[model samples]
Target: MIKVMDRLLLFVYSLAVGAASVFAIVMAAGGFDADWLKNAVDDIIGEDALVQTLVIAIGVVLLLLSLRIFIVSFKRSGGQAPSINQRTEHGDIRISVDTVENLALKAASRTRGVKDLKARVRAADSGLQIMIRAFVDGDTPIPALSEEMQKTVSELVQETTGIPVSEVSVYIANVTQAPTTYKSRVE
Candidate 1:
């Protein structure tokens, strides 16, 4: 999944940055006096021209790899809120995707069996599609609840925004028991 890949890339970038920061800090704190590092530096400085060239190439490759990873990790357009454009007689009307999502959430919340609802709205060929993920009560009937949520969301979106809903897909992610309060024995 793209989300998983993005997270993985971000983790790698973080690690690279952390390592570089620690290395720089140690060098600034006079870690260059360490015998191993001193010897390694001396060897590098004393190497033949061909060997120095190869070392420089290897360093360049690593730098380029880190830079590529850093850029990819930070450049993400998916996190930005999207908008839907509609043409009208007077002008163009643009509606925020968040508005559609909020509309769908409100409609779904009105359904009796739905809880912990989240909605994502996207532009579709016909109009818009509403994808909802929700938690339902354990006793709730899935088919009936899904149908109710679909109808409610479709109708509400159309009525409120005049946006035709191509489809309302309800994914029941979880079923949870009602919350109960417990009394402490000491109290």
Candidate 2:
């Protein structure tokens, strides 16, 4: 719903800017000499109190709406990763998403087949969701390796932080080829 509204607002703003640009260009190119354009401008500025008042009101509303749209677009995606909250006897405890991500990376690195790993932690309804993207050796069995990575990352995060992990999704991004070694020949 918010996305739809944002797109609509952007469309409206684009249309307004386009129209204003055309209007300025035409006027600068002697469009006012045309009878229709001259008559329309005269009518708007002709000292009829109601027409002037209506134009001013519309302009003010458009200005306000444009300002609002600009501000909303500027601050659209300023969201931080969610933190884990725990209740302790003395006080509350909070664990940052970074910590969970580090734990996931550590666990994945320990897995045999994983060559490179990247982990992202996000909050979920049950607790946290860990997403791991990994590159492994080409000979590794992807399905089994991914499952092991998922289990390892989930268990390690839960055990280390004492926070429940709803899911650990593993994505095998690539399979790396072993580097070939060249033998030196002395003649």
Candidate 3:
């Protein structure tokens, strides 16, 4: 949810900056007189207490927005890689999440009945949970296939990356049809 809000802020900031840039460019191109803008702002400020208050409020809001964007720019304190970190006596190791997902897919695809496979991995409370969505051959029973796939994926990912896999959820999405081979007879 926080990430979503940050993205929203970024989008709004981008639009705001673009609009300001265009406005400045137009002003520079003599689309409007600088004196006209100064007079308009001066008139608004001199008009009434309410107008002056509104101008101050708008300035404050924009200032706060800019400050927030500046801070969010540095939210990630360091250049952090997208990976899982492991600490050992020698040093530290980082494994890419993509690597783990690929490992899961590789393991699941090796199962006899699976024709096509894709995998997703997410962090769980104790370990990682892998979800495999597969298209399978119609010959095998889904229950046995799913069981085997789950075991295979979990074992392979853990063994390879040393990342504990808590569960592997297999979704047998569809049964794939085999391609037919054409045969010709000579006359």
Candidate 4:
């Protein structure tokens, strides 16, 4: 849907540019004395200085729309906030929940047997609860691996973000295997 909308917008922009280019050519070639060119252009644009004012307004609106989209996309994905108990006024240092999650994910990825880490947080009355989904080796023992992952993620989050982790839940989403290719000999 988004791709279709983008293509449609691009097509409209291209058509507008083509029309403007043609108008510029006509304006230049005919100078100001061409009555037919003047009437044709005016009929299309109308009498309210449409060419200059409308074009400028549309350009400004499009520019602002694109900038807003860019800023939203660049913002962090997770929407979790720290627990009320998690607030820290440790002198001028300011930290956001999104920053903490980013650092914890980075740390979790450093562990052996872990393929990737995606962390999420939930605010609780006691403290903040963390959930870290890790893709790891399937051959490893689930119990031991889960324990290690939980411990590591909790320690990393606490050390890095200064947030107390009441729970560190690990979910193993998938275990990847090496790809195999088939070879055939031509007779």
Listing every candidate in turn, what is its Cα RMSD in Å to the true structure after a full C-alpha superposition? 7.2, 3.7, 4.8, 9.9
- Predict model 1's lDDT versus the native: 0.86
TM-score of each: 0.56, 0.74, 0.69, 0.47
Residue 147 local lDDT, model 2: 88
Q: Distance (Å) between predicted and true CA of 58, model 2? A: 2.0
Q: Tell me the lDDT of model 4 at 130.
A: 77
Ranking by TM-score: 2, 3, 1, 4
The segments of candidate 1 whose C-alpha lies over 4 angstroms from its true place after superposition are 1-80, 181-187
Q: For all candidates, what are the clash counts?
A: 0, 0, 0, 0
lDDT tens per residue, model 1, 6-25: 57766765776788799989
User: Which residue pairs in candidate 3 have backbone atoms (N, alpha carbon, C) closer than 3 angstroms, thus clashing?
Assistant: none
User: What tens digits encode model 2's per-residue C-alpha lDDT throughout 73-155?
Assistant: 68858576567888889999889888889999999998897898899998877988899999999676888888888899889
Those runs of model 2 whose alpha carbons end farther than 4 Å from true positions after fitting are: 1-11, 32-34, 47-54, 66-81, 87-92, 139-144
> Which digits, one per residue and each the tens of the lDDT, describe model 4 over residues 1-187?
7657656666666676688689788778875567887686676578667676876798886676566556656877565554334434664444566776776687677767788778887756665677888888777787788887777778887777666778878888888675688899899
Model 1, residue 115: C-alpha shift (Å): 1.6
lDDT string for model 3 (82-112, tens) is: 6878889999998877889899988998899
Candidate 2 has a TM-score of 0.74
User: Which residue pairs show backbone clashes in model 1?
Assistant: none
Task: Highest TM-score: give the candidate number.
Answer: 2
Candidate 4, run of 10 with poorest lDDT: 79-88
